[model samples]
Target: MVYPPYLQRSWQRSHNLTNAQQEALEMAVSEAERMTHILQNLLDLTRASHSMMPLQSESLILNDVVADIAEMTKKFEHRVIHLEVAPFPVRVKVDRNQLMQALSHLIGNAVKYSNADELVSLQLTQADSWAVIQVSDKGDGIPLCDQSRIFEPLYRVDPFGARSTGEAGLGLSIVKHLVESMGGKVII
Candidate 1:
């Protein structure tokens, strides 16, 4: 979707519009982007569930993958995303796009639940045989009763949760499927 940049260009080119008109356009654009995000999530969930998501596996630099995603997510503008990873290339075999989607979902989750001024951290570290990517936030932790159900399709932690903030509950399910399909483990 041509979201922010289009909205931005419109704003820059619009000099005659009143403040209220400008605000209305901005809000409409925001809503469009939100709907696009939700629709994409639903499609991804369907693909993941049906085992129809294709994998184009390649050797990828882990740091590059995470850094690129972090850069793109900076446009969110609501939460502070702190990405901590070494500049040295850490290599892994996986479908890069799928992995990016999974990581994006994790980062999005952290950003959504955490307060606007709070920090959301994404840390990457390598163990002997596995790469660990941890996403943490300062928000209230998930309830013990809901922890096991969080990755299930259509399951929401709190009804008034992040989905209310513009995401559908399909994200974690898509994340789980994508990671597992790429032969990696997802630990919440």
Candidate 2:
């Protein structure tokens, strides 16, 4: 439920603007669909975490999920995301939306943290019985010491100061819970 640092900064920056300017700024902020998407994701993750089991389970194609996430993230002008999907459909039995949520969080994080004009890649393939999806970024990689606990709820790596990347720190924790609840595993 925490707003990203960018949004907060924007609000602060607009506090002294004229009425017309403030209204226009608010409208522009409202027009950005990413906030709505992130809020919905948070709500969905909350519901899933509290439920005994995921609500829906079915066979799904992971490539489609990756493509969808890429499409959404392409809206960010600063990010360059690349998709290397396998020729065949990478299918798995799971809740489509849940998996999409997990993948979206990971891919979104990659795009958010990546250096300007750098590429973020989504690679998908099958490994044994598990469908493997890897989202990689070429930005400042996670530090070795903090890697082990990044999945903990509300544990921000750069918590003491301003965050260059706008994240609420709940995304990865939610992904980990959702993946584990479905009897699958997520690696950092």
Separate clash counts for every candidate: 0, 0
Candidate 1: count of backbone clashes, pairs at least 3 residues apart or interchain: 0
Off by over 4 Å in 2: 1-45, 76-78, 161-166
Pick the TM-score winner. Answer: 1
The global C-alpha lDDT for each of the candidates, from Candidate 1 onward, is 0.83, 0.76
Query: For model 1, how does the per-residue alpha-carbon lDDT over 59-156 read when each residue is reduced to its tens digit?
Result: 98898888777777777555567999965667899998899889888888887778888988878888887888888999898999999999998788
Instruction: Estimate the TM-score for candidate 2.
Output: 0.74
Predicted candidate 2 versus true structure: per-residue lDDT over 1-188, tens digit per residue: 34457756767889778999789767656545446655665776677678754558887788887787787777854466788888988887887777877887888778767776898888888887778888998978889999998888767788863233445577888899888877789997
Model 2: number of backbone collisions: 0
Best by lDDT: 1
The deviation in Å at residue 3 for candidate 2 is 13
